[model samples]
Each structure stands twice: as C-alpha cells, then as structure tokens.
Target: MDFETEQATRYQRIIDLLSPPDGTPTSTAKLEGELEGESDDIHEAITDLIAFGELELVNSSQHGRVRLHQPTPSTKAQATLTDPTEYVWHAYITERDGLGRTRARRLFKDREVAEEHLKQIVNVETLTPVPGIKKVWCASLGSKGYTPEYAVLRREPVFQQADDPYPESR
Candidate 1:
C-alpha cells in the first residue's frame, strides 16, 4: 500500500484497539502490545494521533488502551488544528542534539508550554534532518484532551543524518 493508505490503516488499528466502552474495559496494554510489532511508520502515526488530542497514553499496562475524551472547558481542552502541525512536531526536538535515549514521562508534560514553543518556531519541518523519516520531530500541541491525560510515548530516531550528501548506495 501507499503512504496515505498505510497511515489510514494504522490509525484504524489503533482506534479499534482503543474502542472499549466507558468503564467496561479500560485496558490499553493489549493494544500497546499489538502495535509493538508494527513498523516505524505506525509508531509515528500513534505519536501523531496522541499529539493531535485524539489518543491518550497510559501508565499501568492495565489502563485504558486509548481514550477519546470529550472536549470541555473544564478539561483544559483547546482547538488543536487551527494551530500549526509543525509547531507541535518541534516539541519533540531536543534543545541540543548529539544525545542518547531519554524518556520524558508525560512526554507532552507541558502541552501548553509545548504549544507556545510550537508557535515560536517558524519552520518546524526543518527540524528533521534525516530522509525517509516521519516529520514527527515537530507537531501540534495537546493530547487530544483526555482528562488526566495518559498519552505517553517511547520514540527513538531510527535514521541518522549522514555527514555527506550522497547516499551510501549511490
């Protein structure tokens, strides 16, 4: 399948996994396990949905797989789309490069703070220096707005930037 088609499928898979009704089933562990087998593209999709305020991250493996919390004034909810997608992506970028793995629990810990950062950066897509990688390095703000949001993430850059411009195969 093509890129867009593949993305649609990935989104559906995650949605179906998290479709459990209110209070009846709140376990998101199984869903997480299933995606654990997915390719990197799906991983980035998950990150995108989570960042777009459509999915929630969980702590205990037995917690809600993902949630579609209703937006409310009380939930600190806001319209995420009117804002720039690139700005949100940049929230994931490090202050400085040349780093190893580091987990930031509550990855979007400061959603509003990150959104502010998003608005500041003029070109968020420029943050991604590697090829064939999802432009998820910078994206929108908010966790799709789950109460006590739990849209956690565990992403690692699979592609590294080359010092030279030519491809290794070429």
Candidate 2:
C-alpha cells in the first residue's frame, strides 16, 4: 500500500489494540509485545495519536493504559502535520587527555562558536566538529550523566597568529 495508507493502517491497529470493543484496558507492555518488531512505527503512531488528542495515557504503578482522547477540530488539524518541533541541532565538544580519557565537554548553541572554542582549548591541528540534536524533554528535565551522540559536521583549522605561526620561533 501507499505511505499514507500504511500509516493510517498502523494507527488503526494501535487504536484497535488499545480500545477494543470489549472496553478492556490494555497494558503498555502487552501492547508493545503485540506490536512486536514494529516498535518505531508503534511509537510514531502513539505519538501522533496523542498529539491529535486521539489517545491519552493512564499511568499506574505497574503499567500504563492507552485511553481514547476526545479532540477538538483544531487539535486534529494540528496532528495531521507530521513535523516535530521537539528537536533541534546542537554542537558539542569532547576533550580527551593523552590516554584518551575524557577531560572536558562543552555544549553550544551556535556551530561556529563551538568550532572556535574547540580550536582554542586544544592544540590539535584541526577541530573535529560533531553535530547532534538536543531534545526538548531531556533539556527541560535535566538528565544526569547523559552524553549526547554527534556527527562530524566539519573540520576547522587551528588558529595561529600572523607573526607566530611557528610557536617554536617565538
């Protein structure tokens, strides 16, 4: 089937799984197990449903239940758009010692600033720029000891003064 059809089918499957005609509450774990290997699709469907106000989470001590959420026309319209606003590009620097142990790490909003700072702090010939995305939830909740993954955006040359290009000459 087509992409939209497939997505709609997945959404319907999730809805049917959660809100069966019997009205029995399905636990999150059970729903996950039923969905099996299609975790990503299931996650996206649930997120979309929640965003559209078609689903709500009922949290319990053991497991959560998915309940139907009655939505207004506006919310349904907003949910139809698939673009997510919870993620943004971020720049990060990881400094390692001679033994390759992590020495320091810094995060920056601007990519150029991060590259410049990396060039100054460490005496490497080039700066290895790492690109990543910061999530709104993690930033707002303040994770402890959690390091984000990054991709290499670009390499920057180490700065050198005009007269003192060779430090040994000075």
Off by over 4 Å in 1: 1-3, 20-28, 32-43, 61-65, 72-119, 122-170
Worst 10 residues of 1 by lDDT: 94-103
Q: Write the per-residue lDDT of candidate 2 for residues 55-110, one digit (tens) a residue.
A: 56555457556665422112323343234222222223321111111222445545
Prediction 2 global C-alpha lDDT: 0.40
Task: Return the TM-score for each candidate structure.
Answer: 0.34, 0.34
lDDT of 2 at 8: 66
> What TM-score does prediction 1 earn?
0.34
**lDDT digits (tens) for residues 1-170 of candidate 1:** 02365666777677666553232333455556678766556546555455534455433353434453322211122232233232222243221111111123233434455444444542232222111233333332223442221112222222222222111213
lDDT of each: 0.38, 0.40
Give RMSD (Å) of candidate 1 vs. truth.
17.3
